[model samples]
Target: MRFSLWQPGRLLSKKNVKGWVRLTLGDMGGFRNMKSKWAGKTWGTLGDSITAANGYQPLVQDALGFSRVHNYGVGGCPMTAGGERDYGATTHVGRSIENTLDCVTIFAGVNDFRLDKPLGAIGTLDPCTFYGAYASLIEDILVKNPLCRLNLWTPLHRDKDGYDIHYVNAAGYRLCDYAEAVAALGRIYALPVLDLYAQSGLNKLTLSNFTTDGLHPNEAGHRRIADMAISFLRGL
Candidate 1:
């Protein structure tokens, strides 16, 4: 069966359509005039930002005037490129769109670059391959709703001695490579790309800024990321 929208003043059902139909108070021109109250105002984020305990929600609400936001980022998710079978099916790409989100931020690729194990195992993510997969995902999302604006974030920074450094070392995918690849994808799709890898000053800050695990950010780090994102949105 197929579902279709019920135009405001138009007839609810026509002979051409066979499925079910529902009617609502048509567009009253309110939807067009109805600004988000936070339009040009609200900012949204999705990703592992919650794991950081960064007080990102409050910071975003206060700093960006975004009263409504959704955070769907799960730790260890790699942009949903490894297929649903991998990663315990926690990725958001395959999920159905629930709301008309204004801005969607995607923070992925770290896990894809950190698949290290015994027997010389490591992640195999080439920029070209990643871009192709990423583009496909973006296209799928746009097909669902062309009005949703997207902000694709590049992978964060990591030192040579980090736990997952082997993947980067073995694949020769430096932070710059990841940033450039994501930026290229953004340009190709006309989506806004946020260079968190370059913009986030985690390195300049002391180790205290990061979580005890030395990978995820601490509360301070979350605030920093939120601030940067808010600034970028405002500028836009």
Candidate 2:
């Protein structure tokens, strides 16, 4: 079924054929354009972020020679399942309670990072709280589908200026703190982590070229992420 996407008898090139798969899964990733008030002002979503496309799912499919992919990313959503805003409950647009995925990549925390909440110690607080939210979500996934491989993904580096505008911590914690928390969780759970924040060569100066608004990645950035994810999934 996967090889049908790259038939020599067909007219399209292999790259174009693969691109079609990307486009199809892109929408399934829940790329949203939305704005709402949070603290008495309008806040906008990272409408063009490609975390799903650049995530392990599609890249693994492509590298493993499969043409189709399943993406469960929900735009503008945090991993806080039963916490504060309770976004996770309704944000699971693609993942089903019964369906079993071959692999589940935990690539949330961007919105939480943007929220700039102080990091918490893992497994010590309510599972619905900031860091605990991730643990709760992971536990649920594993409990529901124990056979599926699980991976943790850190969000890519954000522009220094962008971070300053969107994030703040009284204790001087920065975006890297969130990434570190994610890596720490991966260590506790013994799950493989793709630290895009430290690994991806995106910085304040070069972020504009890779990202659309110094936050959401552009096509070039997505390509870089896809390359990294393909390598990661292949290794697994």
Best prediction by lDDT: 2
Show pairs that collide, candidate 2: none
- lDDT, each prediction: 0.55, 0.58
lDDT of 2 by residue, 69-113 (tens): 445555555654444545443124323544455655667666666
Candidate 1: tens digits of C-alpha lDDT, residues 49-79:
3322436566656555564666565555554
Which candidate leads in TM-score?
2
Candidate 1 clashing pairs? Answer: 8-26, 47-73
